[model samples]
Every structure is written in structure tokens, then in C-alpha cells.
Target: MKVIRAAVDEMWSVMGQMTSAVFRHGLPMTDKIAARTALTNFVLHIHPVRVRRSWIRMSYTLCLGGLSFFLFIVLTVTGLYLMFYYVPSTQHAYQDMRDLQFVVTFGGLIRNMHRWAAHAMVITVWLHMARVFLTGAYKKPREFNWGIGTLLLLITLLLSFTGYLLPWDQLSIWAVTVGTNMAKYAPIAGPYTRYLMLGGTAVGDATLLRFYVMHVVGLPLVGFLLMVVHFWRVRKDGFSGGL
Candidate 1:
């Protein structure tokens, strides 16, 4: 036990020496001989010298972006769990969905949670945007963040649209069909876009598969990547004030 303690102390000493060398040029530690007492100590390195907890709490209340991010995390987790029991094929898809509701344990609850969370994420993001806009937080240095937020709003809408067809129900089928048909209104590329989306002229097995893949994999992944950038940029730009 004594030898082990000696080795641990030696390791801490080496770490202390390394940290001291790194910060030596910037500022010298004057108070303590022990590494633990040194400001250069690794364990103490991240401790803030000064902090205003009230300011932080107020900042969070003013900035709803963090709440939006939390909702997105909830959606992602519940969505992945729902995907485990859901199949993308048209023929058995509806039956499998029914099985999820009636046969599988907690399947209905999981699907409900995912569905509700997706909706809540959309609402929270919009609220965050509204909060930013109302407070004039989008002005000046935040214009770029505003632009990213706009794109995220569009992505959120796309995510909802893509996920609409997953249940393979009449409402999902017709809703997606109508939505995709609007794509046909786009000049020369419209018809091709519609064709690619439906995988043919009409919604069927191929359409179901495409939407499922997009909802469960493609759009969510894109949203997640953009969300990371969006949050990082928010921190970089600093928190905007509330009106």
C-alpha cells in the first residue's frame, strides 16, 4: 500500500511538472508547494476563478435555444427506439405497426413518445426563433445564427413531412402523396422530383421505403449535424438579451 501510494504521488508530480511548464511562461504559481494546491494542477485547471451563477441562470431563461436542443435530444432517442420495431416495407408495414400498438410491450407508448417529442421539438424551435426575433437578437452579430436557425426550421418541417408516411396508414399515404404532388409544380425538374420521391407515378411500396429511410435515417442525421453547428455558433456569438 505504501509503494502504491508512492507511485501515485510520483504520477501526480509528473503531471504537475507538465502543467507547470505549460503555464510557466504565462503566470507563476506562488502560494503552495504541493501540486494539489497549485493553480496549475490538472484537477483544478477547469475550475473557474470567478463565476456569476445568477447571470448564467438568467441567460438560460432568456435564451430558449437550449430548451429546443433538449427537445431534439428527446426526439432522437425515442425515434431510434421506435425504428427498432418499425419496418419500411409497404405490405407488412401496416400490420407491423398494428403489432407495435397491440402486441409489443410498451411499443405504443414508445411510438407515442417519439411522435409527441417530434411535435414538441418543432414547437420549441419555433418558440426559440420567436424569442430571438422578438428580442431583436437576430440583429448585427447574430444575423448568421438567424440564418442557420431559419434553415433548421425548414429541416424540422422536412423531418415532420418525411416521418408522416412511416405508419403506412391512409392518412400518411395520402398526405405524402399530396405533398409530393406539389413538387410536380416545379418547372421542368418537378416531374423528376416527384418520380424520385414516390419511386414511380404513385405512392406504393417504393414510396413507403423511401420516406421511411429519409425520416428514420437521412433527415434526422442532417438535422443533428446542423443542430450541433447551430448550438456551437450560439455560444460563439454570445447569448442575446431578452426584451
Candidate 2:
């Protein structure tokens, strides 16, 4: 009976540790336990063990960074759904869009969500950067992260620009034409840049294919990698909002 009781106690002890590992929140019985939990738990490690209340105040930070990341997630999901039916060729791109709108179930809704989420992400990332600047969070050791953030913002804009032409509408063609034309004013590299972007002289099948590849694959991968570094830096440097 004593052996069985000992075995049961050991089982319960293992179970308790497992529970603690999974749910590390709430007040611990002691500071040692809290510190250990924060050190050992994956989720807890992502956040600082302690922070000043003002650092996380909604009014000061406005939750813009989180909102922007959330919008990015939404765009990724909806964009994937749209991709199943989308072909990047100029021949089928517009017709695919029309079919998505009129035939595919919830396609229109998904497309609109993707579009609006892209727009909102741009706004939120801009506001987040502005808040960081205004709060003096871009100074000192935090500057590298700030640069990463600026790159993120640029990537967001490029993603939007590249996606603007995928629908193959008249408006998209005109907009891209005007946008690419502006690339020709960059001194030595202007015309070459335009040609590189268009894959030739103008926005045609090659342009559509190039933009589509960048929009759906290349840019997002780079942005995601940057974001991982950004978050890591944020953790290491601590919250600048408190500064």
C-alpha cells in the first residue's frame, strides 16, 4: 500500500509540473516559482517578466503594432484563399476575378477582406511607426529595430502596389502604367528599374507574372523574416513605449 501511495504521489507531481508548464499565468506561490516559470516557459519567455503599467497603456501605444500584425495575418489567410482561383496571366486574370466575384462561394467577401486588410495594415504600420517616433522609441539601441520596422513598412507598400495589378482591370493597368512611369525619373537607374519591374517596356504578361510572384511569394517571405527579427529585437531591447 505504501509503494502504491508513493507511485501515486510521483504521478501527481509530474502532472502538476506539466500543468504549470502549459499555463504559467496567475500569481505564483513564490517569486522563485514565478522566475522559474518565466525562464522555462516558451510563451512567458516572449514577454518580459515585469513591465511598468504605463508601457502597455492603450492610449500611449494605441495597440497599433498588434493591430498591424493582426491585419497582416488576415491578409495572408484571405490571400491564400484567393490564390486557389487566381491565375497570374493577363489572359485569365480578369476572368478569374470575375468568376471569384460572381461564382465562387464567399469569394467576393474574401477578396474584399483581403483588400481592406491590406489597406488597414498600411495605415496601422504607419501609425505604429509614427507612435514609435513620437515617443522617442527610435533612439539608442532600439534604432536597429526601428530600421527593420521601416523596411517592414516599405515591404507593406510594395506588397500593396504589386497586388494592385493582379486583378487585370483597366484601372489596374492604368495605375500600374502611371506608377511604373514614375520609376523612370531615378537618374541612372530609372529606365532600367522600370524595365526590370515590367519585364520589358510595359505592363504585359511578363509584368503580371513578375508582380504576382513578388506579391505572393518573394515580398511576404522577406517581410516575415524581418518581422521575426523585429519581434526578437523588441523583446531584447524591451518596450520603448515605456521610454
Candidate 3:
């Protein structure tokens, strides 16, 4: 379509501009022969050769945000595959879960990978936040990015909480019950919060549906938007520190 072509062309123009900027800064790039040689010799040939060693080290450690993003991609892939076999209902949910674990081919592996990736994302994001905090990366110019990161942390927690109910077992039931009960103590918004979350006074079909939608649709959408804001803010804030 014309729209698709226009979008692609626009993307190409932006990438071309970025490439020009990088080369104009005197970052290393060579002719075809040297490029091939570097590719053959180096472990990560994609990285610019002119970067300072200190920058490389800092990027690896502090860029756990990037790792968190990678894990999120993994989660999304595995989650999609798992969703093909999952039934987000009280009646068929537990059976589908058992089938995933014991019957479906590679289903258990996919589910396990998604679970572990989710946990890793949460841990990495928290560690990334801690690193930023200790480095005073949240100061002044970076405060908005810091706020975005905080929202991402909340989204991660919400993702985990929403996922806990998918198994549709006693554990899921009671865990959600206890979690929503805590929401009932949120000052003036507590009662309304629980009502909106559960769709009723009790955790049943409606509750599962709400949580499922939140996990698969609502929260991921917010996470993605916030992630864009976070990344753009980082670039705008000038890469955090001097190399």
C-alpha cells in the first residue's frame, strides 16, 4: 500500500540520517575489506570501533535496561505460543495448564521460559533502577526518565500479579484474593479499586477474565508505550554520563 511504502521510506530516511551523524562524528568505519576483516576478527563487530573502553564497560553493566527489554521480547514470543493452548477460564484453565505441562509438545518449555523471563525482567529492571539511583542518574535532566522507569516497575509487578491467576488453581484463587484484599486498603480508592478490578465482590469467572485482559492486553500496551518514552528520554538526556 502507499501508506506502508511511505512509512518504510520515512524509516529509511531516519536511519540514513543517523548513520550519517555517526560517521560524521569520526566513529570508526572502514572500506569493505577492513569491514570484513573486523567482522571476522571481532566478537561484536556491530559495535562502533571508536568507543572508549570505559564506555563499553559502563554500557554493558548499566544497560541491563536493554537486557530487560530483550527478556520482554522473549516473554512476548513465548507468551504468544503459550496462548495458543491456554484457555483463560475457570473450567478449562487448569486442564489446559496441565496439558501444557505434560502433554503439549514443547509447551512446558515455552511456559517455563516465559515464567523465568518474566522473573528475570522484574529482577533486572529493579537492579537497573538501583544502579541508576546509586549513580544519581535520576537527577534533574533525567528525572522524567526516572519517573518512566518507576512506572515500568509498577507495570512489571502488575504483569506478574495478573499472570498468577492464569493457572486457575487454589494457589491462583487465594493469591488473587489476598492481593485484591490488599487493594481494598488503598485509602479512598480501595473499595472502588477492588470493584473495578474484580468486576464484583467475589473472584470468579469475571475476575479471571479481568485479570486475563489486564495481563495480555492492557498492561503490555502500557508497558510498550512507557518503554518508548523511557528510551526516547534516555537519548534526549544525552546517554546518562560522559565516556
Clashes of each: 0, 0, 0
Put down candidate 2 lDDT per residue, 15-132, tens digits, no spaces.
9999877776557788777887787787667777777898899989899998998898999999999999999998899999999999999999999999999999999999999999
Off by over 4 Å in 1: 1-63
Ranking by TM-score: 2, 3, 1
Output the TM-score of candidate 1. 0.75
List model 1 lDDT by residue over 1-243, tens digit each: 999999999999999999877665334353333333445556454333333465346544554666677777777787877777777898788988899899888989988887887788788888878877776878988899899889999988988888888888989989998999999999999999999999999999888888888887788788888877776776677655443
Candidate of highest lDDT: 2
Quantify all predictions' global Cα lDDT against the true fold: 0.79, 0.92, 0.84
lDDT (tens digit, per residue) of candidate 3 on 51-95:
445644755456788799899889889999988999888889999
Q: Give Cα distance to truth, residue 45, candidate 2, Å.
A: 4.3
Which model is ahead, 1 or 2, in terms of lDDT? 2
What value of lDDT does candidate 2 attain over all alpha carbons?
0.92
* lDDT for 35 (candidate 1): 37
Candidate 2 steric clashes: 0
Prediction 3 global C-alpha lDDT = 0.84
RMSD of each: 6.9, 4.1, 9.5
Quote each prediction's TM-score.
Answer: 0.75, 0.84, 0.78
Number of the top TM-score candidate = 2
